[model samples]
Target: MRFLSRRLVMPNDLNFAGSLFGGRILEWIDEEAYIFASCQLGAKSLVTKHIGAISFETSAFQGDVVEFGLEVKRVGNSSLTITCVVRNKQTKQNICIADDIVFVYINPETRKPEPHGKTKAELDAEVLDI
Candidate 1:
């Protein structure tokens, strides 16, 4: 898994209980996953197809730094499956994990799934470029 981005938790990001909001973390995960998929597939036309079971193991409070890590699990004909983990940057404690998030490459004109024409080797090579 590559830790790609970090976010600083702020007061506005907190829930009434003063921990980071679940919806906000999910939003970050979705955005990070989309960016990762776009770079790996080298295409901008992609949509999130599915996200597997999510496990919220711990809480993050305001002023904490959290990191988002993602790893490609599988590359299919038109979809890429990835796993995500968000952890506390300071302690490396996992706060949330999603086992699988699927993104489908789509034809911009037709709005239908299209082959991304990328192999695992190709995707790994792109990671080196990043």
Candidate 2:
């Protein structure tokens, strides 16, 4: 996975245990995956279809900086599956991993899934362009 974004763990993002909230991490993961899939497919009318197994290996405390990484795993006719990893920037310790976040392209007018016709090769080329 390529590094996509980073965030600092703030006091408000902590849970009762004084650790980063899992829900907040999930929100970041979803947002990063959405952005990656949208850029790869060149479509903004996308919906999250599913998020596969997620494992949290460690925790973050307030003031810790975390980096979110994402990579395109697969491209279906109408869906893109991406994987993500988040880790503490200073310690390089893994925080969480999400293997399959599937996003489907939708037609705004029809509000239905539509073929994107994109391949992994195309996605790689687009990344190189950036």
Scored by TM-score, the top model is 2
> 1-130 in candidate 1: lDDT tens per residue?
8898999999999999999999999999999999988988879999999999999999999999999999999999999999999999999999999878999999999999989999888888878887
* lDDT, candidate 2, 1-130, per-residue tens: 5887899999999999999999999999999889888878878999999999999999999999999889988889899999999999999899999999999999999999989888889888888898
State TM-scores per candidate. 0.95, 0.96
Every candidate's lDDT: 0.94, 0.93
How displaced is residue 117 in candidate 1, in Å?
0.3
Task: Show model 2 residue runs off by greater than 4 Å.
Answer: none
